[model samples]
Target chain A: MDICKRRLMKELSTAEKGLPSGLTLVSANDLTSWYIDITVDSNSLYQGQIYRLMFMYSPNYPMKVPNVQFVPDENRPIPIHPHIYANGHICLDILGDGWTPVQNTVSVCLSIQSMLAGNHTNERPPDNDSYVRSAPKYAQDSRFIYHDDSV
Target chain B: MPETETYHSETIYPVIASDIAMQGTKTIDSLNRLVDYSSLDYIDVPGHLLCPICQYPFVNPYTTKCGHTFCKECLIQALEPNVDLSVECRCPIDRRPLNRDYVEDIFPAPKIISNMVNDLVAYCPNKSRGCQFQDQRWLLQRHIKDVCDYALISCGGIKEDGSVCSQPTHRKFIMEERRIQRDYLLYGYSMLPPTNARLMYGSSNIHTKNNIKDSASSSESVETKDKSNSLKFDQPSKNNLHLNAIKDTKLYQKLASQDDMPLLELQEDIQIPCVHQESDCANGCGIKITKATKEAHNNIGCTKVMLSCEYCELQVAKPKLNLHFEQCPEMTISCSAKAYGCTWIGIRRDLEAEHQSKCHFIAMVPFLSKQDKKIELLEKENKSLRYHLDNISQSLANLPSFGNINRNDSVSSDSTTYSIETTESLGALPVLPVDLSMTNASISHMLMENDRLRADLDHLTTSLAELEMKQNTLFMQENFRNQEVMHSIKGMINTLRQQIHYILLEHRAFTTNSSNPVHIINQSSKVASTNPELLRRRLSDITRQDVKL
Candidate 1:
């Protein structure tokens, strides 16, 4: 097995054992992609709303960070945050340049959850309309400027 | 008893070893030579022993200056220059600045840490391949190299062209080859003339020769005692020769000295046939190769060696297998009209002609998909509408005046009464106060409460149905009684009319018979006055008859 797959399997087993409340592993049928359903805690501004996070792992995972993005379905929607675009592209450092091999699927989910929780305003990015119209299908393909640390 | 057992085993080991050696070159794939750590099943290794990067017990552990340990390979990969050179190398765990160029920053982990990780117990990587060996992590590599029957090793046989046989075989096969060479060398020395054997093997050869002669004489006597035992006697003599030869050449000493030596050094000129000479290909290719050309046969020549299509079971060469999959007849393919909401899925053969031509989704693509989207939207709207309507109705029913109006408008007034009674009964049922906080115990309690409430509702519904049925029967009975009363009244009116007709006829006859008109008038008046009482009696009798009928 490839090292990426092995590491993913380890992370998957640990996640399945238990996760912090509001984060759930929906499906991980293969090592390449996983679906996790995340619910913002009651204290958050977007309370009672659920969103899905889709993780696409390359064979070079850990060395290269997995592509993490929101997937909007009938029940789940892209969260309305200043750092989150309408196209489900998120501007988070850990998901981009700040990624480390130590941060696994669980930690990534928690970070996104906290990002949503810390926000007081329910709004999209300033360029949400324009960016959404021209954004790449994969969030990792587009370069994100991490300008805000307050969120 | 122990001594005899030892002697028996001592004689037996060599014979079996030689027999295995004579079987010759068996080939195995050397691709999976290294023990894969990720695949090993570790037994409860502590968290501290595990590498922070790979999250597995350390393999080639290295300690950084920050007092953190990681797998050497993981550290190297982590420190590798990024696509963007501006991003400096850093520790994966702490994000501390790391320099890949400086060797002093990271060094090999201490021996204790290495030993601790090595001491961790793990099952053989070949456990799936039927190797049951389980031991310390350090011993696993040696086990795979020296002892594992499933482990692949070089055949170590020389071809006629003076090339070393590159064919891989199991360790057992190589061990056997060494034993066969040992046996042949020993047997030749034992057959040598006494002076020649003495010169070749020195004084040690003389001692072994004496032992072999003694064993040979004892075996011959045993053979003569029973001709039937000759087959068994022959085995001991061969064992004696093997043992004597091994002792004379000091092969046993070499084997005993180095436990890790997988195969002993032997003369390079020995020719051995391929172990798989007459054996059928493991991939079920029926053709048999007669020489040590297994690598060529399996790698390129054999068509069945590679995987076949999981769907169609079509066996093709590995390079073209992926291409075959694109057009495999049995491969599952979706209809081209999938975008138009056609969910038809079948084999490639069917989808190519049958499903595509007949698909209604293709013909009505534009209109149908748009309608489908509209329908889906409408369905969502309809669902919300139904939910709102249910809420409105529930709220309206909660109002007393509205409930009364509903009861009045509905024909079944009894149903309203029954519903009121049911509500009263439901109110009488014990209501378990639910705790808002969800704990394990409270959740179970709530589940039980839900079950009890459902049972109460079920009982109430069944009883309500019964009451409704009774009310229907009562209404039907009331209607029958009203119809019977109306029929009886009609019969009484008809009898009264008949009585009036009879009285009029009598009066008419009397008037006609009388000659004086004034007397007739007076008579008629008297008769009129008397006739009423008689008519009244007759009216009562007729009513009685009607009542009896």
Candidate 2:
């Protein structure tokens, strides 16, 4: 990573309220690639589970949101939360439609933590079947409308 | 009604299935299925973190961005003391950014994978020191909060820690320490006891018992002191008294904090709204200002501004004179009429007349009194016109039927020509003649005397169907007029009901014993938004603080 991008990732990974889960940054086979899990000790639905997530950023870095996804679809697995897609796509506007470059991973993690915590309904998104198979990628298309926090 | 705990047995299935699906398809199907049901079953996690920087398990690992991590304690001691603000620690990647400390996700193994991968991992890094770690990541927070060996217990002094106190915990710690006394007490005081004596000297059991006793005594002392503090001023709240003594300080501390929630937050806390209007914004802004310093600013003169604004000839003054006048001008300030959205900014020399005539924001129509005058005029003209039209049409429609059957058989030819002319004149009016059915009952109700004809229609025809159709049409027109009158009457009633509901809701806010005051305030706020007089009257009565909710 360039000096500037790496600097932001450091403060964001360790700053106050940064990365709600105790998720640590772990490198894979390739030095450039990285992924890990966040154990959200939140009062949210995704509590008590370690959510494995991958963080992929283009060289563009801070100017664009990092590609963060709950890996292995573990704690926040898709076919579950109504507000979240089974394909690991989220319906939160702040994560996508309303995303501003100013937002950091800390804010993103906290938002997700709350998302998992407060969801009373345990059903998957209504369009899970269609979105999962036929439109598997649309959930992350960035073109999908994210009008509200709720689905 | 909310499901507190419904998905216990079946919850295992979803957790397992989701865990496998997230790992991607590279995972073996049989292994995935095996974990799909056995999710979240973990004896403990054996995370022997290996530091990327040291090429070994992290001694005191520190993380860095670009995923090229480090051993924290070693790096800190080796590098500059203050690494956070220093520019030395750069990310090992593209050299573009200096991501200082590397951080790792906690317990990366999902419960589904944890049960399997956990067996493959090394021993706990902290276990060699005799720390018997047997908890999973899920239980770690609870462990640290309730069972951590090093958890800091508050000293529970009366004043906050920021202020100096006559006493300190270190002194108390030394004097009241059971472990310390265990070494001293048995040697000095000769007090070893049998196992049955729970409070015997020098036992680990005695140490724990003493700690509990000390905790209980200190808490009771704190409670007794709190009671005297309140008894001098505040009355008892029964069970809520202790709750309040504990809670009020917390609330006060929260209020002292820089960014506490407004009244809406306290509404959640107290579960009630403050409704004393005397403490509200008497300035008529209808905004509730927090009770703070400078109470004098609350009396700023705003009455004149409200009136001037109404006329569109509003004046302005500096805020020091009256907060309302901060932007008001000597000349009439132009405020766009709130109707037809005339957002024009103009000088108000003749603004009142200009508004009365041209202000689109203000409705062109005037007050209810003026509206009543106009409506009354329209109603009178409509009623008379309706009666005249009804009379003419009814006479013509029933004329044929009302004519005698014997006379029709022998009527003269000139009379028939004369009758045709009369029917043509009557056709101009929008009314139906009386029916034959009415004539059968009584001729008086069926007939109308004409200007030129000596005989009335009822005196002539008594059995024509065409006359009946015209009569019914005339009757319908009369009913239409009646409907308008009834509608105006109903409108007045609705306006009255709305005004009363508004006054009652507003009046209840300032008064005490408002068991349902929040409900009242909510309702009044909603209604007041739509009603100008209700809003204005309420704004005058309620203090600004009352409007915070």
Candidate 3:
């Protein structure tokens, strides 16, 4: 088996057994893709809203960061924050150049959960409309300038 | 079932013997095997044993200078992408700089840590394949290699089409086939007639004879034997004779086939050779041999084996022996002066003796050797002197005044020493150099003293700046307090002036009321009318007042 599949199997088993609060593994179905639902449990601007996170893993996963985005669907929508765009692409440093191999699906989910929970602004990025119209399909391809640390 | 029973009886002996033999000689190719540790069922592995980068148990652990441990492979992969970029690689856990100066800041993990990680208990990696073996993590590899029957291995046989067999087989089936093949090769037979085989066949024969006797003794016995035979064979027999004939044929076949079973079994053995006779010598000897002769071949017969050179005592492989001889320092060679009519020849070790005695170039040899030694010694002294000169120059740059004073003092002392040398005996001239060396030592000592004083001055200057900042804040606070005091005193003076003005206005009103003469006169007449003594006293007081005025 490829290392990506082997690592995914371990992570899948761990996720199936249990996940931390506010994170639900909706469907994995295969090794290459997975879906998780994240909810902000704290009393923040996104407290009552839930967001669906889609993780697409490449063959060089863990060495290469997985592509994670808030997949807007029925009953779950993209979170509104100063760093999160309308198209659900987040500008978190860990999701971009700041990613390290030590992070996994569970850690990513918890980070997104905390990112939503810590947000106070109920709006998208300042250039949300223009960026969302021209953004790439995968968030990993975008070169986001991580100028904000207050999110 | 009957066919299987007969086959098991024939193959059982050699199978047991080969199984026992294989236990001692089992070897697994563990070098290229990649173990997936995440799939293993660990018995509570400690967190410290896991690599923080991969979140798995450490494989080939290495420790960094920052006191963090990571898997060697994980660290390499983490550093690999940054190799092309100019950025320095850092420890994944703590982000401490790792590849500084292009040197990795990591070392092999401590022995205790390696041992502890190896000692952790884990189930076999092939547990999902129905293997139940469990042991310490280090032993798990050996189990998979030597014992785990469910481990997947190639068939390791070529097909009739002249291509290697690519079918995957379980280790259990492969090992059984190897055992059978080894037993056939060593014994030259499929079945071994051990004493135990005869005992097993003898017991069955006795049971058949008892059935024949019981059937002849009574009709009830005949019915019971027929029922038992029916259950055993799943077919009803009419009488004891029929069942007895079936038993006779089974025994006869077992004995007869022991000598000439079939060509099919022989062909299978030929297709797969003995495990001992598998591969060629790994040392590149190019001769294939059985495992029994492998040790001997590697020890002595393999020409590619490493051996120590007899002349130089340097280790060189057998194939490289001639190459080593060309550069061997101890190799014997004729003297270099042979062309000059010198016939001396010997090993290089004794070449010095030849040059010292019989060589025609002897005179030049000693002179050249002496000059070489002298030049080497002079170079070493020159290096030391240059290092001292640089140090003195650096100190002079730091304190120019000190250097100037020391130079003047040394010049004056040198002049005094010269004057004394001229007056005294010639022996005192030798002491002049010693006095200059003493002055040189003192100059270095004074330079060290100057450095210490400079450090002290820097420390005091920083403390003084801190005190000055504190005093400025204190003065500003006092000035603010004085301004508040002055504002309150000015308001107090303004309130006093207003109070004096109000008193002056009240005194003027009283004087104006006293200056109303007509009202005063009426009031005096009213007083005189009320009392005659008041009028007489008023007239005498008025006359006295008029005289005083």
Candidate 4:
């Protein structure tokens, strides 16, 4: 196994024993891709909803950041906010330009859950319709101007 | 998983023989990668054993200023800045910031921790090839060099510019070879020692065996006597006796008689045969050919030799040659229609004419395009030449007028004019006289040039003003477009805010009393559905009244 796979195996074993409340690993069979579910344990928007996150890793994981995005399905609708588009593409700065290698799949999931929990208004992004028309499949590939920190 | 504490002593040095047997002769690239410490039988490895970045046991462990330990390589990788200059590195366990200064404050892990890591025993990576060796991590290199059978040693006699030849041989063979070389150098004799003499020098046991055999027998034989003398020759204390015996020999006298002979001439007389004839001759002809003759034989007479075809790799014999060029399959000849620009390659007999006839680009289009490109380049050159000619003629016309005007000045003695013969209608123009009158003409010419310059400046300023005005209007139009976009954005934001406010108010009212709120919302929705347009108008009126208030 490569370094990334070994690290994921250690993480998997640890997470199996116990993880923080409201954070769980949905599936992580291969080193290149993993899925996680996160829910904010507070009285705020997206309080009860379990948001599924997809993390795609390159062979250079732990040295290079992985691509984290909200995976929408029939059961899990995209959390509506100013930074999240209707098509489930997020515009968070840390998921793109502000990413650091020390961050892992769990950290990214927690950051996104907090971002959704802090929202006061539940609505698609301001230019959701127009942006969704031409959004890249991976949120990391999209060039987003992240000037707001309040989500 | 069994608890490691159960087998604390055994775990330190686990039964690695079977594990080494399974790996079988594979070279270890990294010792840490070879051994999975997490699964070892030793005392339970703590969480700190694994690097936070790679999740492997910490290699070259370093402690940061934040009291967190990590592999040195992993720490460097974490602190690497992304595209932006600001580094976003921090301790993974605690979110304390780490920078270059913080890293410089790093120190090696405590000695006890490092000793525990180093004490983990591992089998030799080459145990499968019959290496029965195991050692602690730090002593592995010494074991491999001193006792391992598979370690390679360089062939060490011939030196080319002080660099020993590095062709590796087995350790046992290289040791034997080095012993032979040392014995040969010490003897100061010819390199090719007699077979019996070599056996005597190979080991001291053989000499003792010969002495014991002689003693067991009743006779003190001559060969036994010579063997005893050879033993004395090897000893340093009896060296003078051997030296005196060597001087008294007839072989020494013969060598002394040849002292007058030039060494160079003697070296030339003993010529070594070419090594190629013995090695390269496959037929075993046993012909002792000299170096000069071997060169000729290699060029012509060697029938086992083969010559490769220039077009392909087909080898043909020089002595029993065949018609290789005519019959070889891969021979590449030029296209028959190469003049037509069909740049195709294959066996010319196979493809040249066939491809040329079907190639459309080669037919007429390429020729036409080639001519068009030439015409374009020629037209560009013609335009440039015309421009240069116009400039030259204008300068020539101004030259003589300036010369005549300067001739009347105090510096006229230094001004010389070359007679330019312009055999054209321009020769009929009036010429200015070289006198006080020419100075007046010069002044007027300067005045007219000044007027032309002033007019050019005026034209440029007007153009600049017009450009500024156009730019100002463009900026104004851009501002208007931006304002329109902003207005639409503001309206969208206002609607979203109102929707959010309504949802919050509904959640509050619904949560307070679910019974009456649901029935009331249902009745309100039924009334709005009956007359949707009227309901929308009333809602707008309410928003307008709110805004007025």
Q: Which candidate is the best by DockQ?
A: 1
Q: Give candidate 3's whole-model lDDT.
A: 0.60
Q: Quote the TM-score that chain A achieves in each candidate.
A: 0.96, 0.71, 0.96, 0.89
Show the colliding residue pairs in model 1: B21-B176, B25-B275, B28-B168
Can you list each candidate's DockQ? 0.24, 0.02, 0.12, 0.19
Q: For candidate 3, lDDT tens digit of each residue in B1-549? A: 223423321121111211222334323322114344444688888888887666667766778888887776666666555646754566666667776334347777788887887788998877887888889877776566546777665555333233334455556555554444333333322243211111111122222333432322332222233344343345323223333443345433443456654322332332332223244666667887543355567766777788898888898877678888877778787776554445777777687654546566655566766887888866765654554455455434434343335534554345444433433343223335455455445665665565556556667888999999999999999989998767655555554454455456445544654896555556555555776685356435533343344
- After the best TM-score superposition of candidate 2, give how far the Cα of residue B142 lies from its true spot, in angstroms: 55
The alpha-carbon interface RMSD of model 3 comes to 13.4
Residue lDDT tens for model 4, B185-206: 2342324322122332223221
Off by over 4 Å in 2: A1-4, A8-22, A26-33, A41-44, A73-79, A136-139, B1-549
Task: Name the docking class for model 1.
Answer: acceptable
Clashing pairs in 3: none
lDDT of each model, Cα atoms only? 0.65, 0.40, 0.60, 0.54
Model 4 chain B is weakest, by summed lDDT over 10 consecutive residues, at B267-276
Q: In candidate 2, how many Å is residue B29 off?
A: 60
Show the colliding residue pairs in model 4.
Answer: none
Would you list the rank order by TM-score, best first?
1, 3, 4, 2
- Candidate 1 CA-lDDT value: 0.65
Give the range of the ten consecutive residues with the poorest summed lDDT in model 1 chain B: B9-18
